[model samples]
Target: MENSKSWVIDPLHSEVLFKIKHLAISTVTGSFRKFDGTIITEKSDFNNAKVSFSIDVKSIDTNQSQRDEHLQNDDFFSSDLYPKINFESTSFTNVSGKNYKMSGNLTMKGVTKNVELDVEYGGSEYSAQGQLKHGFEITGIIDRKQFGVAWNIPIRSGILGLGEDIKLIANIQVSELA
Candidate 1:
């Protein structure tokens, strides 16, 4: 870890959002209000960077207090038991110009799975405060059941209360540590 440049997520400039199909006809959006992440790299381009991220499960917000409460229950996140969702990157590699592939182990509800996400590097620049910052957009799809979030109520044949596939989108801004 010595000699490596360190960067921490700027919560004010970052957002984590997720979307899932509800009733097979509509999409429900939710976000985690609290998260923390860090990246360590020796090069400015960020290839081979080490990445770690965590989100507070209880912070799930769906714009509805009722639904948010349900999400924190055993049927969904079970936030009381597993309070945090974490990801540790195993590899970060450039796929093409400004695009990269990040593979990591995602742990949720005590289940861990290896997942791959597409990363778009938005380039690095100096912020107004004279801090070096890097921007990245990460997108991916994951099956909730794989993470022990398999709660679903079937409305009818070929229809369910919620979708199994969840889309994850994160607009992350990281500021370099001085």
Candidate 2:
């Protein structure tokens, strides 16, 4: 049976941020403005909860119009061809201490790869608006090359314009649906 305590993602209160190495020294951070997700709590155990999310590729933002436009081009995300990045949870395993491992299939740039996220639950409580809210913070890393984002321009001093690894961090706020 499905869990009774279900939570709908509050997009207004949630964010999906990513950071990538620039020139092997500095970091470039950006986020997707249009994304949504959901979390379903299991009555038997909260650890058995299920989660899923989707991000719109066109929503990529880096505070610079030109950079953002370049990211959505064919050399990078190719937003016109691959309109979305999706994740579906395959398994949730409790590790030692307060850590948990969430394995899921991440689909991006027409490629699907299995990725593991280190999840930390921030507990649940009732909000002022008379809604039950659950907080979670998840972090993960993905190789940009694995998702077909291997475009790079080599510069002097062994530096490249874009890095191969991308770091993802998500701060999610889920509200129970009545």
The best candidate by TM-score is: 1
lDDT of 2 by residue, 47-75 (tens): 76777899999999999999999999999
Window of ten residues with lowest summed lDDT in model 2:
39-48
Give one digit per residue, the lDDT tens place, for model 1 in 1-178. Answer: 4468989999999999999999999999999999999999977569999999999999999999999999999989899999999999999999899999999999999999999999999988898889988899999999999998999999999889999999999999999876
**lDDT: worst 10-residue window of model 1:** 1-10
Candidate 2, pairs of clashing residues: none
The candidate maximizing lDDT is 1
CA lDDT for candidate 2? 0.87
> Each model's TM-score, in the order given?
0.97, 0.93
Query: Against the hidden true structure, what lDDT does model 1 obtain?
Result: 0.95
Candidate 2, position 46, lDDT: 52
Overlapping backbone residue pairs in candidate 2 total 0
